[model samples]
Target: MKTTLSVLVENHPGVLSRVAGLFSRRGFNIDSLAVGTTENPEISRMTIVVDGDEYIVEQVKKQLNKLVDVIKVSKIIPEESVSRELVLIKVDAEPQVRSEIIHIAEIFRANIVDVSRKSMIIELTGDKDKVSAFEELLKPFGIKELVRTGVIAVNRGNKTIKIEEDE
Candidate 1:
């Protein structure tokens, strides 16, 4: 099964390397990783997607919690949270095909961030399945390139897994 892990770590050099190394040493392959600053600059949030069984994933989380720089970790599954991803796609669009592509983009609620004589760049933000569906629809149009910010998630409403200061 696929699991999304949200890790809060000290905003210090080598922390990311150490966490990544731990996964590598354990032979765990991370499908996607996105790290960014949180509301508190002293901490950084990393969202990682990994494929593993429930028991294996629990073990991985336990191992992660053992790291000094790792403040906290939580596995966000669909039943417990809301997850989303962002993607940008550039597709070939001549005059004749531009309108068609735009129409499809509109149907997906994707924004056309850039348009040129021969190409259009679209920005889409939604859950993984929606993004994937949009990409599949555009496949026949000849995608020039694409980029994605992997899955990020939070528990519904007021619930959250926040790291507490180590005393």
Candidate 2:
């Protein structure tokens, strides 16, 4: 099973390193990890995806909570959250294939971010399945390069993650 964890941490140097190190030390492989500052400059949200069983997920959460920098760690339930990933693909676009490539991009509502005589760069943001489908379709055109921003997600409704203050 793939588990997504939403972690809130103090925004400070080395915090990311420590968090990543913790996973490494425990022999846990992170499938995807994206971190960025939140609305509050002092905090950052980390979206980490790991492929493991329920026991492993529980262990990961417990271990993460022990980190002093971690403010809160919650499992992002798939049905309750909206998740997305961004991918950029540079594919061969010979004159004869340019139009076909553009048509493919249009089908997925992907943007043609860059173009040159030999290749075109397509940008798409979607859930994993969408992104993978887009990539598979572009592969026949000869992919020159590919880059992806790991998944980032948030709860679908009014629920939010925040730091708790002691009274």
Candidate 3:
């Protein structure tokens, strides 16, 4: 099973490393990890995706809660949440192919952030499948470089994850 965990921790250095080290020591492989500051300056949220059994997911949560810097850990239910990823790709384009590339980018609603005589850079943001499809379509033109911000997700409205002082 693929489980997504939203972990809130103190905005302190080495926290990410510690959390990652825990996963490494436990033999859990992280599929994607995106960490950034939250609304509060003192806290940061880490959106982590991992493949494991339900039991392992539960164990992972428990271990996270034990960390000193961890504020909270919540498992995200895909159907009840919204997620997105950002991708930037630079494609090798010549005059003849430049028009075709631009057209394809338009079809996907991707932005041509930068362009040159030889290549063009596009920025795209969407769900995992959408991003994957966009990349596959541009593969024929030859990708010069690619970068992505791993999946970031949050539960739908009316619900929010918070830290518990007693935890």
Residue pairs in candidate 2 whose N, alpha carbon or C atoms collide under 3 angstroms: none
lDDT of each: 0.91, 0.95, 0.94
Worst 10 residues of 1 by lDDT: 157-166
Model 3 segments beyond 4 Å from truth? 165-167
Segments in model 2 whose C-alpha atoms lie over 4 Å from true places: none
TM-score of each: 0.95, 0.98, 0.95
Tens digit per residue, CA lDDT, model 1, 72-159: 9987868879888999999999898888999999998999999998999999999989999999999998999999999888899778
Sorting all predicted structures by TM-score, with the top scorer first, yields 2, 3, 1
Between candidates 2 and 3, the one scoring higher on lDDT is: 2
lDDT of 3: 0.94
Candidate 3: worst-modelled 10 consecutive residues by lDDT: 158-167
> Among these predicted structures, which one has the highest TM-score?
2
How far off is residue 152 in model 3, in Å?
0.3
In angstroms, give how far residue 85 of model 2 lies from its true place: 0.3
